[model samples]
Target: MAALQIRQDYSAPDLRQRAARERDTRASLRLLAIANALEGMPRAEAAGLAGIKCQALHDAIQRFNAEGPDGLHDRHRSGRPEQLSPGQQAALKAHILHGPEPERDGVSAWHLVDLCEYVERTYGDSEWGLSGPLKRLNLSRQKTRPSHSNGHPAAQAAFKKGAAVTAAEPRGTAS
Candidate 1:
């Protein structure tokens, strides 16, 4: 909407500096749109240039002309930008990989929380403020083998098949 045609007709962004800024921009745009209309520019041309359709532009112009300068706001620029940027998480993985180990001793397995804290500490300690988008690690802990364990992939597969299939058929159904 143009810079001036603001109203109390509908809900609006909060009435602080940001809201006031929105009003000014809207009021200014409203003025410009009306000026353009008055100068005989076509509605489509003016509206498109103002980043809205002619109908929207006309509506904005009407609202401003009737009211004052509070209507031009694009609300909710807060709260994590209010939308997701996909694959932003990749950057975090790269950063986490680059940072120092969280544990002084490299002997122990890493807990998930330890990794997270490590990320915060290592990067946050440095200048960049150390944040990146988050994602699950591609790898996971392999199931620990029992004390009497067989270390074969095929054995594992057979075990799974047996476990899965045994429940379905009773003890003597093969005949």
Candidate 2:
């Protein structure tokens, strides 16, 4: 394979400064050492001391040479877009706090499906399906039912007592 030619723009001061205060300070220092050795010392020796392959060292050195400071930061990667805006999110939070409880709607409690449907229908927007609305809004069931049964002592006593006590049995024969 042909050896890659790279120019390192990192001056000694820059390498030292970056190496000193970074979160990954040691790694940065090692990278700087590799860069220094590549720029001043030797490629093989620098890459070996830095514990990295020559190709990786070459790439780092190239990046340092081109972008300067900002190259060290992670590149921006796009994420999923919002189903609703920040204002919508804040409004939804308010709705969760003091909006009419689900019980008022003849439902026992709020289920995931119910909440999703409510948001879609409330805004008169039919495009959003269950998942979109669900991701945008969250609701849970209310577990307010008492976990007990009442026992009636009067009924129990009535069942135990009767009016047949006056009718006594005949005495048994005795000597």
Model 2 lDDT per residue over 82-148, tens place: 6667776667657655545646654555555665666676665443444544345563344356533
Q: Candidate 1: where are CA atoms >4 Å away?
A: 1-107, 125-132, 136-150, 161-175
Weakest lDDT window of 10 consecutive positions for candidate 2: 125-134
Count clashing residue pairs in model 1.
15
Clashes of each: 15, 0
Which candidate number maximizes lDDT? 2
TM-score of 1: 0.30
TM-score of each: 0.30, 0.46
lDDT of 1 at 141: 31
Candidate 2 regions off by >4 Å? 1-9, 12-17, 25-30, 33-37, 40-48, 52-59, 75-78, 101-113, 120-175
- Candidate number with greatest TM-score: 2
Query: Which pairs, if any, clash in model 2?
Result: none
Backbone clash total, candidate 2: 0
Alpha-carbon local distance difference test for all models = 0.49, 0.59
